[model samples]
Target: MTEIVGRLAPSPTGALHVGHARSFLLAWWHARSRGGRVVLRIEDLDRERVKPGATDLVLRDLEWLGLDWDGPMLRQSEDEEPLRAAVAELLERGSVYPCFCTRREIALSAPHVTDGEVRYPGTCRGRFASAADGERELGRAPGLRLAVEPGELALEDGFVGPFTSDVEREVGDFQVQRRDGALAYQLAVVVHDARQGVTEVLRGRDLLSSSARQWLLQEHLGLPHPTWYHVPVVVDEGGARLAKRRGDATLVELRERRVDPRALVAWVARSSGVNAPDRIGARDALEGFRLDAVPKEDVVFGARERAALG
Candidate 1:
């Protein structure tokens, strides 16, 4: 049997918060309790939005919560060759094409499928013979988009069970590379997981929609698919999701106030249906940890709960 390997990937865009703690702790517990290896990956590819000190804070937060990993930390920006190589294969196979459509052009051409996402109308599909041709014709560098065919893709989530999404209808052909010559998140994540030999991907529920796209990339790239567990996200009392940019119940603030990390851990344990003491370390909560015990609904982290932790 293959060894189960899970990851605790943190994007260095903001300080870690209570919501982050819940997800990270659960990931750590789920992996460690089953004698699986936990890999810590720092997803810092979005350089424009990466906070200067956010990585350091992320490391500190994980340590404070007693979460540990089996190998050296993986930084996404340290290498780009693999990402470039993946794009090259797709381009060679004609699985992806150059897109010169701007945001305004796509918006004007296609209707909005979700709040901010537009179902790309394939405006630039086969519009150019080559990337240079698109640049020459449009007078602008083009991004690379995966050519998605019309069909409904289905995936079984370890937690959410069976799920289906029509990628071609809902998202159309999604970008694999940005117009500015940067790798897209979907491409980067698929390559990273495959290269790292990740077996299980346990993350927040908000990213559930992304699984289908990642699965598509994996299939096209001939990579193995990891078992997915999209657990509930932490939201406010009013059911609004927590935002890192808004500094919602950040761990940094709680630490500055000398809040006990174990208290927060214990809260998370109890929230997940584990009977934990008022203060318990992450490792202590791992003895009988069960992913099935975690609540399916979003965990709330409001002012009252924030005050209790602080």
Candidate 2:
């Protein structure tokens, strides 16, 4: 049997909130329940948005929750060479090309996707020999975009059942590298997950659309595709997704009030539609971990619960 490997990829760009806790806790439960190893990965590639010394705080939060992960923690920024190498390979595979369109220029023609990000329409896709060549033509560095194949890319999500998205129509050639020379999230995740041997990707359902994008990347690179479990996300009373910057839903705030870690764990379990005792540790929650126990729709956090996470 193939070994199962999971990851807790926390980007230290914002505060770690309850929404993050629920996702991380479930990821831990799913991996450990099957004697699998959970790899701790710090995704701090977006240096401009990354907070100073936020990784330590994230580590403390996870440790307080009593989740044990195997091996040393991996930082995405430290693996830039591998990421760049993947980009180079994609360029050579004829799957990706240089894009010289600026954000404003792309916005004029690109369609707004569900994620609120604009998808490129192949304006500069075949015009440049390379990104540097695009700079010579446009007088500016160019972003790199992948040439997605036509047809509906469908996959069975562990929690959401079968999900499909038209690669050509819905998601046009997406960006792999930005004009700022920074790697795009889609490409970074695909390369990292493949290189790290991530056999199972357990995260929020909001990223469901990204699955097709990443799936295509794996297919192009001849890499192994992992099983996906896009669990329901946590939202506020206003029905908006939770954010750490909001402060109230943050673990740091709850910890300040002396909230018990196990109690928080129990709350997360209940919130996810899983039945558990009042006080349960990370290990205890894994006693009967099943993806089906998690809700398919986003869980709303009312005013009262949001006030204290109790």
Every candidate's lDDT? 0.89, 0.83
Best by TM-score: 1
lDDT of 2 by residue, 1-310 (tens): 9898999999998779888888899898888888898988889999999999899889989998988788888789998888899889988888888787888887888666656867667787668666677677679877778897779876887767898888777768888888889998887887888777789999988888888988988898888889999988888888899876666477787788788888888888887666888778888878767767776788876677754445
The parts of candidate 2 lying over 4 Å away from their true place are 129-133, 306-310
List RMSD in Å for every model shown.
Answer: 1.1, 1.8
Give TM-scores for every candidate, taking all chains together and pairing residue i with residue i.
0.98, 0.94
Q: Please tell me which predicted candidate would have the highest lDDT against the true structure.
A: 1
Question: For residues 1-310, what per-residue lDDT tens digits would candidate 1 score against the true structure?
Answer: 7898999899999998888899999888988898899988889998998999989999999999989998888889986799999999998888999998888888889976763689998888877677797788779988899999899887899988999988888888999998999898889899998877889998899898888889999988999999999999999999998999898989898889999999999999999988898899999999867999888999988988888875
Worst 10 residues of 2 by lDDT: 301-310
lDDT of 2 at 270: 80
TM-score of 2: 0.94
lDDT of 1 at 121: 89
